[model samples]
Target: MPEHDDAKADAKATGAVTPQGSGRASKRPARSAPAFGAFVRKEPVRAPVRENTQANTPVGASTAQADGLRVETAQSWPADAVEVGAVIEAYGLKGALKIAPHAQGGKALLAARRWWLLKGREQPERHSAVRASAKVHGDSIVGQLAGLTDRDTALLLRGARVYVSRADFPAPEADEYYWVDLIGLDVANEAGVELGKVADLIDNGAQSVLRIEYPETGKDGKPTTGERLIPFVGVFVKTVDLAAKRIVVDWEADY
Candidate 1:
């Protein structure tokens, strides 16, 4: 992160405003619009699977069940290789299953040609015995695993999670970042003063704000107190260096 001196120099060179004092203030003002293509908010629907469900339940669990579904576990890739999506319910006797993806983009699930199906883990030996795979069908996706040739077979897979590796997805463009990448980056002001780590990104329908976990430090190098919120807008953000894992802002320490 750039220090206070560096920030002051940059502001002077660029003719931008610099906040005085600790910059801590009563409240932060509203931010302006965002630049095109910038990831201002996290995906609203998709998230990690929760624990404490039925024993052996798949990672990405769902309740939409039809008939002809089959379940089994995968073994070829590491845990992170595939993220879990909703399970397949039988579509019809011909052996089709309905799939609900976690993200709006189904590219990750579509790219992975194979899948391991498992029933809940209560019967690990039996769950491990099943195997299945799928293929992309135009906009929607379809899967056909071993022994799942009929509606009855497909119905058996209901509630099973669909997993795919992070590598299966395409890379993001410059200035555009995935919500997962920004979650823990350190946030600081242009003056090189420490603020806080990004606790999370909150969406307010209009825009997103960074929930900073403020640090407790005074001029005496002692802990002061309190936290703050900073809008992740281009006007306030000077630069975001993903490689360095830091965000330099035009904000002041006070407010």
Candidate 2:
């Protein structure tokens, strides 16, 4: 989950925002994001899903068509939805929302539209449904919704999470992978020595690193778990086979 402790911090402290499948979690010192794609806020929210873009529409007069029959259907959050970001503040005088994404060193939230507003970890199910029509600002994203207008309404959303169904994520290009996709694969070395399974990953400014966790049986014959912080760069990582659920690296178990 994204750090909610700083959710109420001023906008000036807004740093690099996370993008879906584009960034990892932060476990080390992370650098600010470079200037990525920024656009003016005037477009629609829904990015065409390769699977079914129109299938998961929201209910509203916004979707109502001419002759008053129908248009799009509003979608609720999926059970396995992944928490992507949090509401930072309202942008402009409109219903635009400012978000701090959880994908460390990434800008994945910029591509998200349909979002569920959860009031922190205590609020299990979503409390509200809103569509996002946003643009990338400095290090965060500013967006707007149909019913959500003015700073007062935005205030009600502070610290609320943004989630997209796991199935809603777009397929990555070749060689690129989603952080969620690599979460559970096994890790090994060049010589076929088993290391551990992927517990998590982090963004250390320069690149993404893998946090592989496994059981280590020490010389005392006692078992202890350990974590390996392997750089996800070309120098350390070799092949990542999602189909095989394994990553073959140029690293050693002892290292």
Candidate 3:
């Protein structure tokens, strides 16, 4: 061993080249990915949730454990979901959500059991919701969402837009129509004189008013640059046919 050491030292001292490549085993530990089921936290549901409430907690395992409850991190939003309202804030400590309705009467907001909550104006149908116990709370509506049992989670959903499928709308009463059904319907007067088309509806404290836009110039060659706010009272609006895409009113085109 001494003679071998001496020989190695002599070889190094003589500037002899050593071999580079060899059969050396690597000692590093192999890397691995986490299992899919390890993600869920077993937090107890805070409230006595309704049996119909079905929401997933983003985690995969908890979804399967919840049985009848739904679990989804992503979804393909339905095409028929009509935008109606938005979430402003969480109502109280019990996980209720406060909503700002798009329409004045909020008939479309109150009509549906399912809602699609989009984080922004972009992709809204991806994460829809199953809602319950919706009612008017001052100027806004307050409601409950499944899996949102805590106030913190509700607060996080401050700017989420609300959309409800037209398929789930409550059947309209005889002679009554939803505000969405009235939009874009052409308006004409008693003498069959075409007034204009329904541009939009404005809500006063007492009732809703229809805003009509004229096609041709009235007295001004550049069209009526005035706001035609016609009251949608029982006396003014005579007939509304969504299928026919027309509305007959007791209004005058000149006036």
Candidate 4:
């Protein structure tokens, strides 16, 4: 794995190769990237102005109808909008089931009114849809799906995945972002030099880090790429704007 400093040096030494996202690069005159280490100001990523969806709308609003339940085809949901949590088997006879969220921010699960369940298998298939309401149960969450009303019914939900809409989530505080919000954004240094797209976020217990993928060309138009991991600390990351789908960092093109 390359470090941020190594990436900067590679970019500067190479010159004006294809910008990072182009998935191609060629030897060319090196351009001096912007000085991003100086400006520490934060900026909003500006969400597109749109009329707010109706407040009366239910959670998983697109799936709902006049009958108070909605069915969502797997194809209809945006990949970024779904969250995965595990159902830890039946809690009791009342159709309630134990849930373990995939993240510490799991409390967001209880805050939403409805969830989509898909059972896990050797190869999980999306089937047997259910609508449910959730509430916090000690350190975990417990919820009742409309069709599950007994231990036997709940047992069927064991190891099921819980999918909730991003819209159902509460607004994050300033300087904070949900991991999903940051996953696909373009990252750049203050100097406006492109780094790479955010490939994944890793939680190393103490803090989160972003994995960035950098593309390189090899004579031919085909590109090869490498990855670098950067800590998501205030010192490294200056601003994150999900609306703009970009992350501005305090790093240097040659860092």
Q: Give per-residue CA lDDT, model 3, range 28-92, as digits (tens).
A: 44223211100001111132233322231222334323422233234456767666777776788
lDDT of 2: 0.55
TM-score of each: 0.50, 0.66, 0.63, 0.63
Between prediction 2 and prediction 3, the one with superior TM-score is 2
Worst 10 residues of 3 by lDDT: 34-43
Write one digit per residue (lDDT tens) for candidate 2, span 218-247: 889999888898766544566788899998
Tell me the whole-model lDDT of each prediction, alpha carbons only: 0.49, 0.55, 0.55, 0.55
lDDT-superior candidate, 2 or 4: 2
lDDT of 2 at 5: 24
Per-residue CA lDDT of model 1 for 189-247, tens digit only, reads 88899888887655554445677886576889998756677765566666788889998
Better of 1 and 3 by lDDT: 3
Off by over 4 Å in 2: 1-76, 104-107, 128-132, 218-221
Which pairs clash inside model 4? 5-255, 15-30, 34-191, 36-190, 63-70
| Number of residue pairs clashing in candidate 3, backbone atoms closer than 3 angstroms, sequence gap of 3 or more or interchain | 1
TM-score of 1: 0.50
Count the clashes in each prediction. 35, 13, 1, 5
Clashes of 4: 5
Prediction 1 global C-alpha lDDT: 0.49
| Tens digits of per-residue lDDT for model 4, 122-183 | 63434333446664554455666665566654554455567767776555434556666677
RMSD of model 2 against the true structure: 12.5
